[model samples]
Target chain A: MASQPHSLSYVGCNFLRQRLVLSTLSGRPVKIRKIRAKEENPGLRDFEASFIRLIDKVTNGSRIEINQTGTTLYYQPGLLYGGVLEHDCSPHRSIGYYLESLLCLAPFMKHPLRIVLRGVTNDQVDPSVDVLKATALPLLKKFGIDGEGFELKITRRGMPPKGGGEVIFACPVRKVLRPIQSTDPGKIKRIRGTAYSVRVSPQIANRIVDSARSILNKFIPDIYIYTDHMKGTSSGKSPGFGLSLVAETTNGTFLGAELASNPQGQGTAVLPEELGLNCAKLLLEEIYRGGCVDSTNQSLVLLLMTLGQQDVSKVLLGPLSPYTIEFLRHLRSFFQIMFKIETKPSHEELQGGEKVLMTCVGIGFSNLSKTIK
Target chain B: ASESESDRKGIQNAPEKNVDGVEWAESKAVEDEDGGGDVENLLKEEEEYGEENDFSADTAGALKWKEDLTQKAAEAFLRQQQSAPNLRKLVYGTVAEDADEEDDADEELGGLFHVSRPDKESKQKANALDCSKFPVETPQDWDLDEVMNSIRDCFVTGKWEA
Candidate 1:
């Protein structure tokens, strides 16, 4: 090697392969050589000397030894090794201190190699307890090691009444090197709606089916409501009265109503709410206001209403029609008034069941007005 | 011979209908003529001739006759002691003594019977295998001791990264 370059770069290589590519700095190849036992790396030597001095100061001038062989370096702080630190400390904390030191020296390394820190104590307060407490997750993230690839294994040792033992903290350096992908989808193209399957109770199902059939039967008098309701309208002809009303426009075509009974003896109306309520609201608002609307607008409104009907069918007999909502509001107010009607003990004795009978009559009249509308 | 005569007389004097009737009478008459001599030899000759051709009375037949006599004698003894107190205990004691004697007789007979071995060499060869000499190999991938030591050091020394 004739006058090899002074600066050297570290690159992964297989010595047996007999191929070498030197890392270049300033348009020149740096010398690639391993540090010998006698000839230590200048930076490493400086670090050891400073670290030992600090330890000696902390330990009140106690002797400290730095053993270096090949690439391995060991530090032995005789009697004062653990004396400088608190007697009882978390192992994680100590490991965190080591990691912090490593991060400070990271810029000096020619090539970054993955560092694994294993074992931290949590079980009992022992010699290694400081290491366990020192290694906080936030501290690790600070060192650019916040990724799924970074792994940590912590061990806890038993003390005193239990037993003194070793704990481990393992932190793999791969986490810092791994790439992160964006989790968010960039733009909103079309709004997607969620679908929910609803079960209808038997009493409610029967009421809905009966009400729907009753409405459909009004269209074609002679035609059977259940059978004819399912049949398509005659060519170029609208469905008869009740059926036509039930077959409201949903997305340019009349969204047909499906009559199905679930396991619970309840009928279910299956329609997408997006096509039902939303479209229906838009269509009905335009239609009621006498605004000129295209066929698509009309169909979209109808589809939204049909979807609204499916959504409401689980609870109510009919779709969430404007009239139905108004009626419900009225009924709710009426019930509130009824609740406010105070009855003294004496009044109760005088009226007996007559007051109840009168309340029922009032409810019946209210329901009749709502139904007619 | 004289004792046999007395036994024949005793059977003849027994309730006539209970004298084992015609079939037993014939057997007894043949036994009396043969004088119970060489009964086993006669049975061996009969067996050599095959069971179908055997003319000598079967051992089973003799056992059955003995059983019948024993049952009759037991019944008679029980009847005689019907009025005695603790009759069950007395009967049980006598039965136990008889069982012990039978067991002793069976042991003697069993000792007299011997079976020859098939092969001495093969048996000895089968027992000669040394099971203790073969050593068991530890699994290559799993060094439990090293892992355990690592764990122990980590926990005791509070050093997590090694």
Candidate 2:
């Protein structure tokens, strides 16, 4: 059987050499010596409190390193231990502390020695078993400490009627301490834009649709520009007739102009001027307000405005300006209004009724166009 | 005619006499076993009344029933004995003697060896053992040195019971 390491000794009364023997799992021993005051032995410092504070500083990413004999030990972020220390001096000197220190120092144990500390309760008070129950097993698993080597011995230290304290010790299973790492992932990924989509409620959708229809109706109206005709049947010739003037709103800011002209015949034919300018102005306003522009609808709004101003008797047989046509095409789909007009030949002519109809259509189209835009 | 018959039968019976000087007829006849004729009957009647009035029998019976039930309680006891397998028995015998001798030798070795010298395997075994397995017992021989040594061994090995 192997003999236990020898205790420290002093040769003379003046000199005392205290030696500490730490053995590795391979049975190799490392000896450390510290000289102390002759009158009193060295007691433990306030390491317990300091250790607690130290562990508190360690977060998920913290690490500690200790170098011994050219070998570096690394302890990564994990569980920490905290406990009290007890000392015994009889045949030999020994120090006892909680196994918690080992846990805190586990990250630094590249060649750590397996050790144990034992103590009994010094008081009759209820034990704080919750701390042990909660932390012990998890710490063991985290540091990979073998269950067999980790020991906690508690005893009643004092006589009856008085209380004793508890002693806790943790030991590594292997002679050489193993490296550890935190299992927790550090951070979360960030998202851009609105981050999520919101669905429009039925109430909101209904309101939007109702407002769009109302605006469309106010911008376009149904009305007759003329009601009389005198024409040569064979030649299809009509006397020159005055054009009706009508105005419609484009976007929310500009008005579209229209002209209705008559053709050379007894019957009156109407030609309206296209309102591309007003549509462009309105489209620009919408763009300035940070809303998407429907170029097609803008052009159509311009077209209808200008065309409505044409003479009733004139025949518009050819295409208008390319710019006008393009503008009309762009505004075609976006207009909230549909123009409906009817012309009938009657012997009796209502005085200024055509102008009244033109004015009403103009006002209605402006209001509707403004609201929808 | 009734009065004449009465005078003929009792000769007017003599006038009735008062027994004041003697107490009552029953007291005067107390010396005789059967002189106090109705006294014994009166005592018998009183005893019967007492029996009818007293109702402690029911209470006494209840107490007795409770005591009987307690006395008949189920009882169980466990007794443990040293019964090791043959191999373990042999090992225990040899190890026990060796351990005893080694304990004695440990005292001499104290100055040469540090008590805290860590033994990984022994510590592991100690840690693995159930704390309740070895109970603390007062040894027949109180050796401070031996007790201290045992305590040190327990501390180093981290095993203790009871």
Candidate 3:
């Protein structure tokens, strides 16, 4: 691809996905230079290459050029041509890494995106498939992108190192999203979770559920953690166990937290009960960081709000993540939009930490590529 | 001077009292002070120019405008700060420059291989791991009764507003 002088130029390999995503959405070309240029074994890694490949697959006529050492990547973004697609993501990172960008781009596609993603479903790194299914899917529905077609189904659970997971994600395309006003995230009414064990003993799942329930029951009696014991083919190549808990508020807010154990041979063997209790503590920490959306899905909701119809959208979020902060800057560059951010101090006592109120008028970007049927 | 001082106090108390928010307010207030000083110097230069033309120290009406210039700028600064939320500016306003300075320090150290400096805080921050989990910074001791009571209102069983 010939580098256009007007393209937005950035340095380093960090935030490559966001730069590409926003550029694709806004139809602006981007040039990323000095990607791992200073490192001993310089240039883009396999995982990043996989991400770029996935991006190329999902779009139409996107011209991507990387230099001899694969350090510099110049991408001229094409139209979002979404269709039924399947891609095997690199096992270096979890499927969640790829899914995060897809969530941002799926709704604005030409056709509804129905993609089957196969890779590490759960890992210590990145937000797992369960958490995204529990938290991000519901958050998308708030912007009125809901129908029978919208779903994220995990057919197989895979752990890190040797991943063999499979999950199907389908989202309906929308012409224009309704601008949301979600300032109030009401009191959590119930706690729900999935304690999944694959290729491990079935009793381990029970042990996890018992220990997790012991901790969470102190707060709310409406706690129900289901133990999912996948057998045979549904259990992926790697053996692992983990927990994903979601706290549902009275006003339909879902704050989710998940913890996957160490892989089969990564390190010391983890006790299921200990993993369960620690995961419960993580859930408590998430509750303390309570907001309309959880920390993991903060960027997703913000992106949706930015792309919504041209009306004011306000959301109360607890503490912005570093990724979300960078996303905000990228949003400003790509869309020429900035959010009205305010720190909302918690009222009275015991209500967790400081919440950030983000207000922005949506760019009113309609899906021009969507075919009229 | 008194007006500007009081306005500074108001600027301090204008934003919500979080650790980050307070620090941001301080940074902005410092910028405002710098801006105020520059404008005051410009006004002084203008006053000197006027005195060069007409040369009278006792022209009270003319001198008062110069005196009020800083006061007015301070007041305007406070007003604008109060009106628009500065949190957004704090987050995305300025990029950290320490990393750039360090990068320039070793542009061509050995002609072949440039000297690589140790990773500074800003360097690590710029190329930090991209994960969306906002880890608990100051973990609250939930064992204590006082700490437990703080979050009681968050639950249905906790105290509800009337």
Candidate 4:
């Protein structure tokens, strides 16, 4: 179980999750040092500790070690022994922090991954679960990982700082990922979203929906933003309101944006009408940076493409995010795959911005540990 | 007084008059064509680039009027190499070099206690929060006529070109 061909070393803690997730998938050992080594109380923070513990829960035989000062972490990745799991994520960060990595590892697991994550479902820090469900699930389907078991359901709406949100995410395992060619993102046909208000005036949701529709009505008439106001235990521990918008294209592309009210008492109180209008504008910004996959799911799709059956895969993306750029570097270290990057300047008048054309041949990474039914 | 001082500093740093800012801007625009985009150019219309990578290596540079064969061949190879580097080396190769820079922040006080430097932005970045959401650097104003026209074709209500 401890066999490793080569151990890749990285410094700092910025991309700890990406390095660890890629290592676990590739079965490589990773050593990360100087984790806030300069700080007075240097070491991994509580949120990162929670993330490592969550990773430990999803896999078996994994070995993780941290120095006394928590300044260094050594991880020997084990097989993805995925099964039923539950995790209470730290409130310092949102659940989207952990869910991002889970989306990468779940498909290559020995068994289907079924996990109940409890934490802040919607916050300013991460892409909320609603946005992921609206955008990421369809992006995964493009790579042929679809099945009856693939679903992401938010059973309880949670907001920060005292988060009580609960989300159930399940995904089916795949022996080999299918190669994809997603070059053209068609014109948007309709816009759909959910305006969720918890422990707040239900009237607030209507106000959000109306203002958002007012902005979006100029483009398409098929805009429908549902107002969902959860109550009691399902509403979560705090009072909050937020909106998650998804614009669906004719070619089945989903571009998403979301905004959550400042968590109870953290910052300035946001108006429901303003939140809705701003969220709509944000969606337009996403569309301007048009790509087959939205900005948040760029790394996930790229990872899946790298693990696909040794065939060529091509994807057009908007400007690569800083996080995606780092992920690209990490993929080379673990899997020895470098994408052919071509900058595709926007050719059409009034298109959002420049696009990036990424092309690579998959290494044909197969799941050897999954049991055949 | 402070504002005037800064204005003087700005003028001192400005490029000489011989270098036309317009020509420099044009050359910068062409250079940015390699990676970044000029958002203002959306209204100037767009240019199409149809690059055929598969047939280029074998069929390209079939010319008799060219001089310096070695230089041309070298330039072609460099263009191809620039698109995709030695990816594995680019990642792990620089990591080993960066391992040395990590030790510079620890300044020992009196040979026993170590001092932490808050001035290093990299240190803050290394320990920053991990999130996937990429916020827009420059959000286009939706109310502007040109900005609105830029994304009009993305919607169903807009005109579609053949």
Candidate 5:
């Protein structure tokens, strides 16, 4: 247990989740300091603290230490003893914040992870559960992390401010992930979306659908947007409406865009029609970017590629988001893996924007804790 | 105003005037390296040569051929910039591997007073909110006819290339 590799040290609170997740996956120790050190409330925010607690719940024998002021933290990761667990995520940030990290760590766990995450399911910040369910779950399947058990089910709908939503995420464990080579995104065949409303008029969902369809119908006649208006206990605490759109390509690529109304008592009130129109435009922008994986899941794809079975994995992607760029840097520090990134200009006419072709060989890390039948 | 005053002062000083002339000649020689000045020099020599050969057409055609060479080169460079940006270097800086080497040097500053060494950009990024959603920076108006037409080929209903 004491024979771990040299610990990596970093400063600041940004990207704390990735650093810890990578440390757990790579079996490394990490020390982070100066979390909001200069601020009036200098320390890890409640949401980040909640995230660390969630990480603790999933793993076994992990060592975590923080200073009195909580400005510094040292994490020595333990085995990913993933089992049935539940967490009430801090509502300041949406559950997407926690779910994104869980998505990366789930497949490599000893036991298949079945976790119930309760918090804001849809919010202005972070990728909503609906978008991830539609986009990321399928992307994981492409890497062969699929089985009868893989599922992300939203039992309740919650908006921000006073979140009461709950979602159950279950993923099957894999000893080794299959390397993928997905360069061609192919043409989009159809568009599907969900317009959800809670504690608001159910008619709001229909108005969103109609406005979004009006814009999307010009591209393809195959368009379907479901209206989900959860009521009673399933409706959660706040009143809100939003739309999440996903475009599926002929070659199994998914591009997604979503917009949620501002959390109750925050910002200006958003009109459903305006939100729908803007969300449709956002989807168009995503389609124009045109890659094999959605922008939100770019880092997830790269992470899976790095953990594949000692084989080269190549993926074509749109512009690298700033968050994804930092995740790449963190991957290097943890796994000592560097991606060969090449920009591929869209040579074909009417095919979105410029793309980047990423190539990397996996570290061939196999799950040691996985019990053999 | 300052630039004009400096030029006037340089002219008033005799030694400075000579130095300025030398610097101008040096820049002209550097421009010759770019082949701009070289072409004019070659044409001048050719005009003198053509005085004997009586071939005016060759020199005129040479001048016309070199007319927009610099402009064409500039356009080609801009096209390259728009197309193939070095994404690897963009994502991971050139010194990414050795980025921690500076930290070791900075750590030992004066021993007693710990040096806060994080630069402005990294310091700001260090505490920034961590969220994965990439919002659109500049959304294209979907109502515009040309914007709608730009992505027309992305759909199955669009024409398939034979």
Candidate 6:
């Protein structure tokens, strides 16, 4: 590295995680200003601050500065020094929020990242740990980031508000990621799901399973919805129930949908049957969007594709989500990579909605921090 | 459908129509006759029999679209394909970066005036909550058989092509 790259500048608090993660990955400084500056309670939110601390934990000698009012932030990234660690993610946001970024940085670390993230595991907002475990892990495995050490285990169930959930995430560091060319999304062969209830009646889980199965059974006979009811200490501080469904395709693609009950005392209580039915419909909607990669993990797949070996990596995805659109622009800024986006209409009969074929040649981003054997 | 097709062709072959509007129709009819004359001669007996059975009520029935169904669908699909805006341009267009520049210019103006710009929508988007979930907007009514059948082939049990 001859000279430090110029810092990228941005405004506002939205996409703060993406900016920071890309800055760290690209080894470029970043200056973000006017974060909720005009709002009554101005400055960095607790979750954003917690996110910064986690980034600091994974990296060595990184310099981070925030202004007096906390509306401005400046970060100069350091080498990714991953190791065994634990982080208490802000309860304001779910652990999934932090885990999503960590998945991007994990493979490029100096050492394997074995961290325990404790916070809300399942909530109305954000992807749940259950869905990520079922979907994202498989996506990562396709990129050859698999071994006995690659695992995401949820030790406790947590809802929002007063979150007390815990989970362990571990990933192996790789020198470089393999380029992928997955276009064909095979038909869904089986549907597997989990209906989890914590500090709630055990019967709720069964009711959710029965209702969800009733909707999904119309398409396939191989449907299994497991009932997971945690007792005493494992159930987090809140009393809630949720259902997460994943449709497994024949070509190893997983599309997931989930619905969680409102946090205690936050909104009207949700019936298990109603939640199950709605979740099933959401899963159907996902199937309608039909792509090799589902919506929630679209950005992750794109990021991995950008950092792969210097060869063309193509993926068939559903319509680009707004977050992914922003991520694409950020990738252009950080890595100077632009994808060839082509809209593929459903030309065949009854194949669901339109799909986008994304193609990009990787920047050949190798993990320089990984110690050579 | 037939009217729109003729109107489109009429606009494209405007030079021929300049001589006479009726002459333009006669020319199109002659072209059609030249193209279909061979096929019509080969199936003349079956064509006469088909015309004999073509009751007026059948043309007005729900199955009317079945007339030239493949050609009509192909034309409609082509129209849709051509009308769709280029998605690559939409994502990488200067419009988005222009928004950022406009925000910066507004901020500069505010700095001089010592007053904040009240751009509600862009401001809200700048500070919006970040979540990865792409929520289903306007979810289809799954109970409807039509909607259910839309994604029927997505499952393994659906018909498989040999």
- The best candidate by DockQ is 6
- Which one is best on lDDT? 6
- Segments in model 4 whose C-alpha atoms lie over 4 Å from true places: A1-3, B1-119
Q: Using DockQ as the measure, name the better of candidate 4 and candidate 5.
A: 5
Stretches of candidate 2 above 4 Å error? A1-34, A38-137, A146-179, A183-373, B1-162
Candidate number 6, chain A TM-score: 0.99
Report the lDDT tens digits of candidate 3 across residue range A1-373: 3664368877677778888889998888998877766668888888899999999999999999999998899999888988999999999999999999999999989989999999999999899999999999989999999999999999988888888999999999999999999988989899999999998899998999999998777788999888888888888899999999999998999998888889877899999999998888888878888889999999889899999999999999988887788889888888889898877767667888778899999999899888898
Residues A4-66, candidate 4: write the lDDT tens digits. Answer: 578887667888899999999988899988887766888898989999998898888999999
Estimate, for each residue in A207-319, the C-alpha lDDT of model 1 and write its tens digit: 33344443223222322222112122111111111111122211111111221212121234233222223222222221211111111122112211221211211110111
Q: What is the interface RMSD of each candidate, in Å?
A: 44.8, 50.6, 2.5, 3.3, 2.0, 1.1
| Weakest 10 consecutive residues of candidate 6 chain A by summed lDDT | A342-351
Error (Å) of candidate 5 at residue B154 is 1.5
Q: A273 in model 4: Cα distance from truth in Å?
A: 1.0
* Number of the top-ranking candidate, with TM-score as the measure: 6
TM-score of chain B of each: 0.14, 0.17, 0.39, 0.34, 0.45, 0.47
Global local distance difference test of model 5 = 0.85
Worst 10 residues of 2 chain A by lDDT: A351-360
Per-model TM values vs. the true structure: 0.14, 0.16, 0.82, 0.81, 0.85, 0.85
What is the overall TM-score of model 4 with all chains considered together?
Answer: 0.81
For B1-162, candidate 6 gives per-residue lDDT tens digits of: 756654554454454324334543453456322423423432453344346435422344344454443334334534554555457666776435467667666565434563456878777888899888899889999999999999999999997777
lDDT of 2 by residue, A133-178 (tens): 2223343443245666465543312111211223344444232222
Better of 5 and 6 by lDDT: 6
Which scores better on DockQ, 2 or 5?
5
Model 5's number of clashes is: 0
lDDT of 2 at A322: 26
